[model samples]
Target: MESAAAQVGCLRRTSLSVSDVEGRHREMIVGDRSTWSFRVHYHSGDEIVHMLAGRAMLRIGQSARRVEAGETVVVPAGVVHRFEALDQLGWGFVSEFVAPGAEGPGPAKTESSLIAGVRAMLEDRYSLRTDVAQIADACAMSKGYLSRRFRQESGISLHDFHMLIALHNAKSMLKGGSSIVEAALDAGFYDQAHLTREFVRTYGFTPGVFRAAWQSAPRLPSLTHH
Candidate 1:
């Protein structure tokens, strides 16, 4: 897949990129105590999170659980959950959405209605596996039409868009201190190797080096509410 920087339709963010994963709809969140933390939200699929460093609390269902570094937490789909850092030291983790039995079609051709619908579908059920044919079916269009319109309108193929989303989320997770493997899974990539390839392709830097630089840099401004 082409890197986000190489794609004309790719959306750009700060070095610590964060965005919705297109196909599998997974999202990687990087939260710090000094800056900001994650907000309460629920996904259509299961959410798996692994803490990389520091301390925090996860509100799942009706109970609150303490989550420390090196710990992993899983929340079933549709369960309301929120995360907060425990101290000024802040915390970092990687999260991914997974739906074992959910069903959905892929996205559509490149017009406003088709693209909007495709975007909504991706956002709603990104954790589930899908294909271009399925998405075109959902859009009531042919795969060829979907491909042409999408490429013409977005300046990138549908598949590339999905990869872009995954890379963006992975970068955010890496910045948040997640290991290469953790970020890979969280961002819907195949594995660490896959993430490395995408990372280097998207940002022209390896994940390991990016993490090192981020760890040594000044802390990000806290976004947590008072």
Candidate 2:
């Protein structure tokens, strides 16, 4: 697969990039302890975000959504939206972009079982096997079919979804003062560079930068409310 930068460039050239932000992308921004707010003006491409931590309100078009830890939402392209982190809960979001292509339309609503299973794997690291084929089998589907369905249901390929989960876990470890190499191993990545590559792709910053930002920020109350 092409690097995230290359993919972003492709989306930009195709006029599929979000206006303020250029290109199809995935990212996580660790907000400060205080509430952080910004208007999201997206021109093209769709977005699916899974909130891993904190509480936030998402304004999509004229509708407002309250999102808490473990909640997910979809923002269609061209919709004016904004997100604000409420209270002390520092937010972690996993986002993916969908460009126009053979992929067809945006992500379809996925079955609760599938979403629950995927979320479980992400949270309970022990339950997840690193092997793609094994995961597909566990889902009771062929690899190719699982990939297609995952893309259709999640607006991202199965591999990208798994990588995002791994990245999220790696970030948590790194923020907790783990070394990059150790974080990579704990997150199921092969090596530091491999984690770095995915980290940059998802967050537009290196893991070191992300870790520093997270560590220096004031601590938020734990997200025990769910």
Candidate 3:
């Protein structure tokens, strides 16, 4: 068999780098904590996250845990997960694998028509103060029922979903040269302090720092490897 050895994406980060290993989607990953995002995402296959250095607060589905250096977490296919590094630089590697002949991981199990409609509505009006009671009424359901079902399907509370959207908008405005205060108000935060608090909790960093990083770094280090 021909050797499959090949160097993939560049490591524009700290002196460390991820070596490509066959089978795993990525052999390793080493980057600043800012590289991690708060957005909950999933894979089409089993993902193995191995921490080589530092630590992070990891959320898998409704469960949250701390993953430290030398520890590992296995995320089953189609499960929602996200990570927030405990410190400025956390070194880790993530591997993805899908069994042969199995169906590809596509959508979350909870993506019903109702959930899709709800997602659309939130995406459209995320800046407004959400009234779940009204949303429930519109859907002809009780507040508690809608809340529980939405959580079950999205792996996030409805309020959090709104907040995430708001933060996303704020981050974009910041990238586009909006002042911190402007970004906060535009994204529906009560004030800069309000946006700052939520930004820290969600991104493990403050809004000012995020904007600075974006301003200072114009481009990702071209994905290179040894």
Whole-model Cα lDDT per candidate? 0.57, 0.55, 0.61
Give the per-residue lDDT of model 2 (tens digit) for 1-226: 2356744542332211111123322223332233445424332345677777778888653567788878888776534456777766456566555343434222223334675475455555632254658667788888788767655544445555566567656765765778888888888887777877666554445676655545554443331000
Ranking by lDDT: 3, 1, 2
At residue 54, candidate 1 shows an lDDT of 86
Show where candidate 2 strays beyond 4 Å.
Answer: 1-111, 122-130, 220-226
Model 3 misplaced regions, further than 4 Å: 1-50, 54-57, 62-112, 126-128, 219-226
| Candidate achieving the largest TM-score | 3
Residue pairs clashing, model 3: 9-223, 10-223, 10-224
lDDT of 3 by residue, 1-226 (tens): 1112211111233222222333321222334333454556544445677776777888876778988878878866445678876776654544333331224223345457766667567767736588899889888999999999988877878888678767767866875678889999888888887887787566444676656545553332232111
Q: Which candidate, 1 or 2, would have the higher lDDT against the true structure?
A: 1
What is candidate 1's lDDT per residue for 128-161, written digit by digit as tens?
A: 2547898999988999999898766554567765
Better of 2 and 3 by TM-score: 3
Q: Write the candidate numbers in order of decreasing TM-score.
A: 3, 2, 1
Q: What lDDT is obtained when candidate 1 is compared to the true structure? A: 0.57
TM-score of 2: 0.47
